[model samples]
Target: MPVPKDNRPLRSPNEKGRYRRAWKESHGNLLLAFAGLIFLIGLAMIWASPPGTPEIDVDLGTVDSADQVVSLPPNVILIRVATSQLNSEGPIRIAVYDSPHTFGNPEQAIIKDSLVPIDGFVVWEIKLDFLPEQFAIAAYHDLDDNGELNRALFNAPVEPYGFSNNARSLVGPPTYEQTIMQRPTESTAIEIRVY
Candidate 1:
């Protein structure tokens, strides 16, 4: 019997197996190439966009004399922080948030400051002339100097922290409204005590 061109039979099973293997190999190579193209496009998009916002540093040096403090403009806000655990190591980090969305996010804070702990009170004089009329503050005693509010199991803070107006929360952190304060038209002082 003569075999038709479309119905040709393989001489051996090995020939049939080879045909299937070649088809599978070509499909595998096509899939790999498609995945690589997607990855390259994603990388190019990331490179074209700018990075996230940079942190704003609010350190303006220390004021040792009463004259220096008096010289500060009326827009200056004197933040007097009192911590019972003053003996703990590391600086006291403060973040000022102008909006509720940015609250608790130190990176999004309009103003950020860090102060060395003192025996009586650690003060931070921040000029808020450029800030909004209303803002909230979140401060933490970074005992580990790791620049983060270290937490243990159940998300309980290991270090002492406080908010403006000395706000307290039964569950988690205080809401932005609880800690919000009006910007003073003149030089004014506010206190925050960290537990």
Candidate 2:
């Protein structure tokens, strides 16, 4: 099917104002109330969610490096996210752990970068809802946008990446326990560092 063109001529400021105000007064409150209802319904739907939901919540306050919410609510425990605005130079590092090592990777990693418009350096939060027990969480930092990590031609990952618990990177990706965590009830903060 052909897509419709939204090329209708622009409206005058006065015309726009009148139409917007009328709609606002007529539908604003109703819209808000409807949105509230929907949010509540979403929470309620969790009651029917699968039995594998994992509960996770953490509070890191406001991190200066990057802003992210990693914890999950009770009903919807599992969540997924991606980081972006990385400096290909050396800033493409995400530390799920500060000491042991970091986890995740940027080699053609999806989300975050593609979804956002960036400048200088920035990390985006890609909020996803899932059962805590359904999927594993791996937050990777990509130094470059190429589909694969830098290799020495020997095919070893040339970038520094880590998993949830510094789970060693085997052949492909790590397993759930290797990178998964108990869902958080509150929001947790993770950072994207450069290499």
Candidate 3:
């Protein structure tokens, strides 16, 4: 028996080595290109991930200043917030940043979902694994899905902004010093206004 001939042309009949040569030249680069594509895909997934938000019981009394203490022995922290009203769904994120680790950096791993509902006179307590001399607390509602605090094009706009100790209000994020609060190992309360 004779083998049948494949009549159809794999490449243009006129071209001698177009297809095979192209594949040979591109084969090595193809793997690198594919690897690069995979890396980019991984990066996209990480960037698109939802960042965990923290919920701290805001305990605030309209005293001259705000003072708080971390429950010692166990180093448990208590946050008492006193607010007149709540944003419909805004500035819902409150973060406590540990200083020296960088400002506005969240020290607690407690995310802001499936914990407590925003009721009147919100109170939250968290265990302090490591206490720092100072930290910054921020409460904000992520209205836009872009994440991070939203600002105007000129880097100027009035959005929901709050800091530890109810620091000075700004059209944008406040300076590092203003947001810093002394974290002593005692029950301390910082006054914050709901934006």
Candidate 4:
């Protein structure tokens, strides 16, 4: 007998398995090709991306030395700071403030600050660019090398510290006027004893 041309359900229970296997075999290659295309597109996007830029280093304190010349004043003061009873042989921090605003503020009077490392003795001969003016001195022995004076939890100084004219504070550090020391001549020697 000839096969019927009518669109009736021809897949029986036994033929359904063969039909599914044939369908998978035919679409397997297409599915693999689609996945390969997606992988190639991803690789192409990654290769076409721009390279990252290198990091740059910048110096904040850089200045043009050619245009600016540092000239010493005609009447510069040469002050010799001698320390006695320094508990430790570490760096000695000395600060000079010519005004009340810069008295306890080291950042404001940074130019007048000096850090001298004690080499078997405690004496530092520093030169000031300014002429004779009202100035105050605050010195401290940095025993911990932390660049600042270390203090206790109660705000008391843990390191040996002293002010000019041997000024001491009852509750806190000496004020601007109390620690003031005059420079009578071009050069003078001021001795401070660390407590």
* TM-score per candidate: 0.61, 0.35, 0.45, 0.52
| C-alpha lDDT of candidate 1 relative to the true structure | 0.77
Tens-digit lDDT track of model 3 for 111-153: 2321122653344565554545766676654544334666666
Select the stronger candidate by lDDT from 1 and 4.
Answer: 1
How do the residues 1-195 of candidate 1 rate in per-residue lDDT, one tens digit apiece?
Answer: 466689986466577688779879789778889999999778655633323533233333356666353345466788877665656768888999999999988899998988878773578877868668999989988888998999986686778788999887656788999999988888777777665
Write down the RMSD of candidate 4 (Cα, Å). 24.8
10 residues in a row with least lDDT, candidate 2: 94-103
Off by over 4 Å in 2: 1-60, 63-134, 169-173, 191-195
- Range of the 10 consecutive residues with the lowest summed lDDT in candidate 1: 48-57
Shift of residue 129 alpha carbon in model 3, Å: 4.3
- Report the Cα lDDT for residue 46, model 1: 60
Give candidate 4's total backbone clashes: 0
RMSD of 2: 21.7
Q: How high is the lDDT of residue 69 in model 3?
A: 40
lDDT of each: 0.77, 0.42, 0.52, 0.62
**Distance from true position, residue 26, model 1, in Å?**
75
- Which tens-of-lDDT digit does each residue in 1-195 have in candidate 2? 343488566666678689679878889879989999998678645532323423233343334446764434333322222222333443333323211132243342332233221332334443334323222334444556554456654364555444454455335545545655554454444432222
The clash tally of candidate 3 reads: 20
